[model samples]
Target: MERFSNITEALMNEAKIEIESFDIKDGEKIIAYFSEIPSISGFPYKIILVENSDGIVYARFRQWDTEYDFTRWDNGVYNLDRLRIITDEKILSQTESALLKEYLSQLEKIHLPENINKENVIILDSSLWKFGFILKNKNIDYTWKAATEDINVFVPLINLMREKYLDRI
Candidate 1:
């Protein structure tokens, strides 16, 4: 099988961006872990990558967070991502279920050692955290509001596939 991580690292490095990986030894900077999130969870690593003729580039990594998908803002609005869930892990056989549960419980919170966020970024007045990798909670501010309502979305056969995304992380 193709080593999932090697491919991810290659892509990120080629883009002149470093996705977080096991090889980093500098005490696991949060930014390092910031890249290649899904892969870090023993799942696929996906990035919102936009490459163009010019060298400038920007990327966002996906991660699993155990919380709600939407939040309210100081502006009295909500913020969220309308995900089209593609696969469900909950449909696994009974035997598979047992193993998956055990596997998820063993994962670490931070694969690296350094502080996850930069010094200046601070969450606001509310207490709700992000659903996955999203930084700002909409409850504190409407800055991260979803662009559109969900359309043509599919649910995974497994009920906890979404939860697995959080537990695995």
Candidate 2:
């Protein structure tokens, strides 16, 4: 697992999501957040989730299709022509929000290293998963390359969001 300071910010910008647009109460704190960035095969798509202290979860799912010019395909030249993006947001139900909080609690107890470098492994076209949490006295951000054992602990949470939100995209 790796940590990044601007992963969330960059993702929000890419998805054209405004954090201030969310109706988060003044006293409501952000408890946990998650994002997924897919590879070129799934380019122009991003998923994000933010859960607040008041058991409110906000989801943003974005996907786009691009028209590419491949006239010089043999020479490996690809030009972008047009791009269309579609974005969706949903405020999770009370039951789903509660389940998300429970999953986050379980995630907080898991043992995850600060970093792991697999020098022997070569990963291609894999997704990047990022998670952020506000603990007792500090904020933690964990980024992983593709699916790793350390990050798999929260698969259920990811799956839940994907099934409820991303599946429609």
Candidate 3:
């Protein structure tokens, strides 16, 4: 693994480890919290991803402490419409697993956007929450969180995951 000086490299390594151990087991979940330039109300948005047995996955997107929202997508083969409508449990058909696997593979290729500078910046405010990821299963849970005023790496990954969850991958 690369050293911690590069935040994006470190996060990609950590995410790969968690993804390897995930196994897509029933009830396994990976939740992430990201703080973009804080909203006018001063809260960060949250993203939750739930993966169930047989490669089933569900995603929820919500503004900080508010109701859920979803983007519209052209109905595709192996639809997740029910999950989209109810924002709950649903399964992707076998044919969809290939696409899902491709998405997962993209995670391995995550690179810090060329436009983002690697130089670090310190945040004087102690109250700001850093971007973080939490991995949990029936037996154990682990998390890695970082607080930073700079958006060195997270913005791209967050955007990628958001697109994937919205079926725009």
Please give the CA lDDT of all the candidate structures.
0.26, 0.55, 0.36
Q: Which predicted model would earn the best lDDT? A: 2
lDDT, candidate 3, 32-124, per-residue tens: 433322322232333445555434555444332211211221222121212212222234345444554554455345542323322355544
Residue-level lDDT of model 1, residues 31-131, one tens digit each, is 10112222211223322222223322223344323132112222422222321112222233455445433433332322322222233445432222122
Best by TM-score: 2
Clashes of each: 6, 0, 1
Which of the two, 2 or 3, has more lDDT? 2
- Please report how far candidate 1 places residue 110 from its true position, in Å: 40
In candidate 1, stretches whose alpha carbon ends up further than 4 angstroms from where it belongs are 1-147, 151-160
Ranking by lDDT: 2, 3, 1
lDDT of 2 by residue, 56-154 (tens): 677766554322312223353332222245567778788787787788677678765565333356787576666666656567777667444655565
> What TM-score would each prediction reach against the true structure?
0.18, 0.59, 0.34
> What's the CA error at residue 86 for candidate 3, in Å?
14
| Residue-level error in angstroms, candidate 2, position 52 | 6.0
